[model samples]
Target: MLKIRNLVGGYTNTPIINGVDFEISKGEFFVLLGPNGSGKSTIFKLITGQLPCQKGEISINDKSLSSFSKLEKAKKVAVLSQEVQISFDYTVEEIISLGRFPHQKGLFKTLSVEDKEVIEEVMEITKVKQYRDTQFRMISGGEKQRVLLAKVLAQQPEVLLLDEPTNHLDIKHTFQMLDLLKEWQQTKGLTIFAILHDLNVAALYADRIALLHKGSFLDVGDVDTLRKESQLETVYEVKVNAQSHPTVPKPQLLMTPNHSKTKSELLNFDTSFSITKNDQFIHVQFESPLRTISNGVIGEGIQWLKHFCNFHVEKHYNGSNPKQDLQKWMEKYEIPFEQSVAMMTAVRLEDVVIVTKQIEDIKVIAVVTAGTGNAVDITNSSLSQSHEKVGTINSMVFIDAHFTDGALVNGFMSATEAKVKALHDLNVKDPETNTMATSTSTDALLLAVTQQGKETQYAGSGTVVGKVIGQTVYEATHKAVQKYFHRLQK
Candidate 1:
């Protein structure tokens, strides 16, 4: 429904969207991706009539965008900009109702049933109904964004133009809002043009991505075509690696680290327990050295576990002399004896899922205890049947080990394959069972699995197991616990 060819525009009367070209089909979710100053917002402005398109052709449904007047543009499409300022004291309903202004005839135009229904439906979809009568300024930034979304939805235009719409939003709200838009695009056939700075989100949602570098369209294609190991480095001037989202079958991108962040800039030290009768409770000791940042945040690195799980953190690390920087966090967080912990985080709550399953053929069972906590499993639990009910924790992580939070799959063959790979890489093995272990370091969320029952012994690092305890345990435990603790996040 939207098409741009050799499009060029920018704020300075200078070119920002240099020679960009692409076509988005009807109801497709299109995304514009680039660095902070790459002029993504300018492209949105030029298309929305806020700024003139200095060069190139912009069209909606084969008609030139430049042909539309201000009112005409509003009739054709809705634009939600990145930088918005709201100083009005109007109620949420009033603000969303304002979206209907363009469609109104005069000041006294009577509200139609259609308009009323549209307003109510938009409010409900955007979840601004609770604040429908509340003053717009009183809500949080995220809630206010939703209200604005309601206003845009109220516009009832055929297409959407959003710039960093998910900025400042929490994961839940981001997913909810985007999910609503996705539904609209599917059922209502609304075309979308969104400016996204997050590669992962872009990868997950966009139908096609236009990657921009210093004021230029470096590449344009679907998620797979746009995400590549080498080209991404050239566009962002940062290293990145691509991997498949095991479940979604999409091309997921992870930025590679320069490693120059610091000796402590990107670092993690984690230890797991044997989880034997002698040590039913695992003792985990983590040492994270901190490197100062313009902003205190960690980076996700693949070859390293940091990138996959987003365990990036900002903490104070004393190097000249080994001070207790890491110790203070361990003590401060009060990690339970068998609980998991996540480090360098500002707040903690429940977002953990415990999944258990049964693999009867192996004559073994597995229980995986995982949360958004700071615990990593070492081994042996891969063969045991019963999972643990250990407490929660938060900590800095080393991704070279197994996760307890929802990472295991259902089938034993694949799970065994992953385990064998991890064990081979870690050079660790089960003395009796002789099965290899699987390992990953991403910190997004975690799962910890413990196996109980049966005579299980580790044999070697490369041996493959026909039966899996981790899978069985994951199948058995996840759902009920997921529902009970989902609201822990504040």
Candidate 2:
């Protein structure tokens, strides 16, 4: 456990750390975050006794830091700074052996069996065992960082302090280092205090964070509390958008650049999409990539796409892996699979309906293909009929405006409701239940936005963007359903 109360210190008479207070609990991964020259390293120096504390007290395990002698402190704390300099050309094993000096006894200070075991263990854990006989200066920068980490771990100190521990490592090695540290923190019950500049990594690993700004502690709390856009923007003096991580319950900050647009670019909301149709499929290519949310065969979930496709399939088309089939189809057509949203429908591609609407500066385009071969009243669908291929109705809505996350979700809801309304008006029925069909068994929908023009905060049914989306989807779905039924009658 480390504690600081009213801690103030600096290199000179003037204080860089102006009276800040905090504590790091045992086995806690506590991270310190701040802009450059924000006294983060100064605080680290003050705690490590590299700089004298000018004001209040710093204690480890309830004992004042000043009370610990050089060797005693080395046993209790180990520091892995941003850089380490050694005049002699020591081997990797020799560098790690130095950490055991504080624990060695007798004037000879020989390496005991326990010291050798610890040294080997640290080298193995840090993945530096292969380089144990090599000169420390001969390795790469990242490898040198890992070697230094091994040296500190060999000390077996109760508390570990790191300054930008991953600065010299690449993405792969960065995660590996942090993963090792996290494992040691849990297994060995080691306390870790680190200064990190990558907020997302801190958000992922830090048990708690302290934001240092202008020689003072601005806030100390969990990642969720400190990762707010307002807090980060003020502390770092840059614009940031904080969004939830896709697969985790953590918040990640995305930096927003100041990109200026010309007057023509800003006002050009009427950009047309090129539609290429064939008996096999219908592809619509946009002028630029659009921010999208979809439940398609490919390019599902949140994506940025320039191509949208409705692939025509037979009524009995039941491929075991439709996604793989769609990928191959896209490849055959020379369409980039990663930059496309594709869906399959039993309906004819020639019968696909397209509608466009513009309300003020915001424009909405809706595309639909419909069939009733496997319609289902979702609330009354049979269990035996649940497993079906792609649904008959495939709908997509595109908006030429910026949309917040909430607006994108709300727009999807509005479009779905409009489609259901169109079905209800047409008296489409689920033949098995003899009741009105709410939707197909596995309907797919896509909502995409240009992510330019004015920002829309909400797009519920009552909002202007939502209204346009609803009207366009309803009209397109209605016309597509009529064409499907008309073809059946023929």
Tell me the TM-score of each prediction against the true structure: 0.58, 0.96
Query: Where does candidate 2 stray beyond 4 Å?
Result: 264-269, 386-391
**Model 1 poorest 10 in a row by lDDT:** 289-298
Candidate 2 clash pair list:
none
* 26-124: candidate 1 lDDT, tens digit per residue: 989989898887777777787777888778998888999778887777877887765546777899899899888668776696667788898999998
Once model 2 is optimally superposed onto the true structure by TM-score, how far is the C-alpha of residue 329 displaced, in angstroms? 1.6
Position 96, candidate 2: lDDT = 96
Could you tell me how far off, in angstroms, the CA of residue 369 lies in candidate 2 after the best superposition? 0.6
Worst 10-residue lDDT window, candidate 2: 381-390
**Top TM-score prediction, candidate number:** 2
Give lDDT tens digits, candidate 2, residues 1-490: 8999999889889999998999999999999999999999999888887888999898899999799999999999999988866789999999999999999999999999999999999999899999999998899999999999999999988999999999999989989999999998999999999999899999988999999989999899998865577888888888988878999888888887777676665534464567889989889888778889999999898878989998887777889999999999989998888899999987878888989998887788888998876788888838556334334899988888899888889999999999999999999988788889898886889998988877888998999888999999999999999998898899
